[model samples]
Target: MLDVQSGGILLPVFDSVRALAFVGDLSMGQPTDHSLRTGWIAARIAEAAGLDASIGDTVREVALLRWSGCTANAAGFADVFGDDVAVRLAMLEARPGWAEAREAPGDAAALMRPLAQTHCEVSGEIARILGLSTSTETALRNIFETWDGAGLPASIAREEVPVPVFVVALAGDLEIFNRVYGLERALELIEQRSGKRYPAFLADVAARNARDWSCAMDEASLADFDAALITSGMRRDARAELIADVIDLKLPWMTGFSRAVAMTALACCARLGLDEAAQACIYRAGLIHGVGRAAVPNAVWNRPCALPAGAWERVRLVPYWTARAGKQTGTLREAAELASYAYERQDGSGYFRGADARALSLEAQILAASVAWVALRSTRPWRAALPSDAALQTLRHEVASGRLSGDVVDALIAEAGRSVGRPQKSATQNSLLSVRETEVLRAISRGASNKEAARELAISPSTVRTHVESVFRKLECSTRAAATLKASAMGLL
Candidate 1:
């Protein structure tokens, strides 16, 4: 694998992307290895179809990342449909009544087109961020398109759609439908979608060999899929933030939640006199602690009233899923394990494993406390965000109740009180953006929509759009998440 240096440390591109893909699976309410299985199926299909070797590799990539854009439009899904996770799972499995539900409110095509556009754009940007081949990126941009020119964001169709797109689409269908319905039913359904979702020839290829492919996939190892990724790896400097950004997108109010927790945890680690290695572990854990959050539906998260017992049960399993997904990857195993403990209480009052203080490490204690602090300060649908002093009081209450460690709470509170100044104007002097563009960048980086940024700046939304386009051209980015990542890395925001 290639290496990219960040503060004199090497970051694995494959590891980071694979980790995000796991979260993507959770977002879609699927098992953690869904993408890996799809990738394997797509590669086999490509090879059997006598495609070029490079095209086969791209097919694998497109399959693995086909759902990477799910998180980008998660909130929109929640708005249109009550439970984003359940709706998406039904959609993918082609369950009865899903189409009716999608069209219940209004025109499904009109409602879905914008959401699809956002998903495609963000996913394509993710491919660009990983420095994947242009072909892979292009294929991903049209991931939802179909052979009949009827797909969402349907700008291209038929021969204009890349071969990898159709291959991956058929492979994904084989993987999901076959597993959900038996092999015969899966084949029947695929046949029904032929000449619509994909070409009839591709459906014929999959139907004839799906059973063998499914058996082979069941026997294949994770190593087999990762082998291709390692050989064609691309490195990047800011992979962790990519995950945090996508995770937060499930809820608009939760933008940058993980990064805030990580930064706070890092400061608390320093205040607690932890070693550098321990501090780094805590920081990374904070960034990914909410990976399990993806498994919980946005509707559940944004509930306006207290969750019922059943909903609470689902919420409690959030960390369980995080820990389970962690074991699927090597590089992220340790951090993900620690992240899974974010909710564990010192008094054995927390969820999903409910280990008491004696079972918790200091790093886990710090991470948990940091998550609590950040959540208390962030606004939620059920309650207004607590002020800093009030949030600190809540933490102290947890400490008094023997649920949080007093030492960790004190360290976090100390870090919270510390002040720092922003980088000087010189930091942006070389960014080559005008003052207005910089303002727009900073606003959007903070999760402001174009209209919100325009409202804040007392300008029209159209003007905001113009500035956003200009910013994209100047920064060479296509999505707000990408621009935000680049701006943060460059200290321009």
Candidate 2:
């Protein structure tokens, strides 16, 4: 039996982290290997500076994870800059005009503080969940801090910012600037910001040997990093659900969308009498199918009118990036490859590859149908979510048009119907809480405020408060955020 709320699939820690780094790349408007290259550069910088071996390892992790929180604050960026991807890319490249544009007409720091806080908290939480060292978590939380006390979310100066933060900042600047601008210009820019952005000594060290480092990166392969670059050992498999959660965060309204698709795909597989291995593959594919979604900016996705040719081309490449990321990931490669076909059609009209039914695997077909079903039932910025019957009718129309497999659509609709209003296992059976308290926990886990949960549950604010307190007490957590994290780990959410 598949638990829809549980994202408990096992994956290697590196595979999950690297896949997430791909998401970070898309969110930052960089290529898929941008984080990987950043990690390599940071490790090299730490080595050249004669940092401890342990610090070098942590530097690699911090560099790869520097942009981990980008998804958490993407909507906030889109709100401020209209095109989050473009604005972030400009900021990274230090394009001559961005400083003026970034600070124009308002107190940018005041507006950026909250967004930075959200990013740091979420990044720190992800590190903690991965069971990384406290130092790594600390570095991630202060990733945006500057040497001069001008950074947002606290304005902590000099020694307060973690060493890995400085190392990664310089490494990122080297990676981005060296690529965007040549070594001479990149070195000059780093020299100018030396005291303000990072320590002057580190910048000098980089300026002296940046040419050699860039050449080494060009010649080195990812396998070389595995043998040479030091990284923390992950003894056990991490949860794949975290990947889904972070991917959905790129579009806030789509929270839980990946898990829904995964669970529905699993249910459809079972209904279709697929074997357990096939079911797991389909479920994993469903969760990761949206990895490419990060490549497109939030602005393009939010547009109400029909997309122009260029925008439509970007939309079609979503699964292409997902597949590309999977090919780079060792453990989840198969699932990722299948995930890339989530948009294919039976009649050969789908995107990124346009493979017909003959070329599509059964698992791919099932996943494609599952994605369509869940997407139809979920609301988007341009339209309200279709009700269940309406969603079903839409799928039926697709099936009739020869674009979807009839059997797959029927199985999905059956699973969805059976799941509607189904009573979940009681909280008493899973944890020490009443049914109402479980409901409150679920509501808050989705980021609802007490008043909002109260309104949604049709109970008074005080009653909601009572249940919330009981939930926190029973969970032994002092804050809603802590409670949510604990509950998610325990599969209570």
Candidate 3:
């Protein structure tokens, strides 16, 4: 059996790409998960139609990555089209030629000229930064291109366009029509685009295979699908790493966020005189604190102003989801719980449960301070990145307000003192445990039954029991609660 928590390590990366896809789909004026479902459906359709497995894989990857560039220029998009998310969503339902006119007049040339130019440039840059292959980048860049040479860059068309691009574009549009209208309306829309916006052959294939596509990608449980995919030979290590990467991709400022947070928390624990083993636990917990943000919508995440009351409530659930997901893995349960308090205030005003300072775990306090310091230095929708001095001042104010721990704030400020002239980016320290030990520890943290932990980690129950005993002994604890408390106090949670 594979370690479930280990499997989750990939979620951070996958979720990031998925989040970008969601943002792009939503920003383009489609419903959330529209693009994902389309990509899933496209891949399934290609497989069902006997396209090569590799082609199906590429199609799936391309579909998810197609709109990745949208979030890279979210602020810019908002500037050009007020309420960026709304404008893009509206574009999805707009009549042909109406989108262009909304921007300009019968001067179609001038009207679409800038939007197309901006879309291509921004989209390409985003794809490149996310480390996509050149071919993938090109396909993404040409996602808006038509069968005629009338799209952006004004050169590529028909056979000149990448097959994956063609597949994704056609599949996405068809999925949208099917959801909003019906089977007949969707086929009609595809027919309308047969030789212009879409390739006739692909359109015909989609129309012919519409039933299979619909059945395969309908509203099914993503959790079950993800499990099946994993069991069907998805590399556990790769999947975990990918998940981590996606979580990191949520905010540009958080590119290596989990690692940095883990490292910083460990360093802070060390500075406070925690033993090496306890510090290791803190570091691991820090690496996975934000895993739940994957479940939240990008609109609320990238909103420039105060969120609507309902949206704000949804935003607050991100931490709760993170903890819930972590609990599923068994190794990061404590870390997940602490992460739930990341947005919490010492004044007892945080989301989910708002335990005040006394009830807050030490790990939670350190995480709260660390996240605040890091976020202040990172760019966000509501503000620009703050200079170190300003960020420190803000942290100090929070401390004074009883929202952060005085000790942690002081330790972090002291850490900042050593880097007076250096940039204040987030950083991660080395892992305290060997790879195998970390795996065992992750399972232990989840409160996994010894037998279950053994099964999940592919080790004997006795071996798991031995490791658990060693873990408790090394951390100088007699029970799980004792170990958890010690870990939290040491900032390992």
In model 2, the clashing pairs are none
lDDT of 2: 0.83
Model 3, stretches more than 4 Å misplaced?
1-16, 22-32, 48-50, 95-134, 223-341, 352-363, 375-394, 421-493
The residue-level lDDT of candidate 1 at 308 comes to 94
Question: How do all models score by TM-score?
Answer: 0.90, 0.89, 0.62
What tens digits encode model 2's per-residue C-alpha lDDT throughout 1-493? 5554445788877777888888998988997788888889888888899999888888988877788888877877887777778888888998767635543357777777777877787777778777778998898889889999888688998999988999999999999998988888899899999999899988988888899999999898877765554365544577888888778777766767888888888999989888888888888898899999888888888898899999999999999999998866777889999999999999999988999999998888999999998889886878888998999999999999999999999888888878889997767686777878888877765556789889989998899999998987887654554455556556666
Model 1: weakest 10-residue lDDT segment is 1-10
Considering every candidate listed, which one attains the maximal lDDT?
2
* Local accuracy by lDDT, each model: 0.80, 0.83, 0.61
Please count the clashing residue pairs in each candidate, in the order shown.
0, 0, 26
Candidate 3, 461: how far from true, in Å? 68
Q: Give the TM-score of candidate 2.
A: 0.89
Backbone clashes, candidate 2: 0
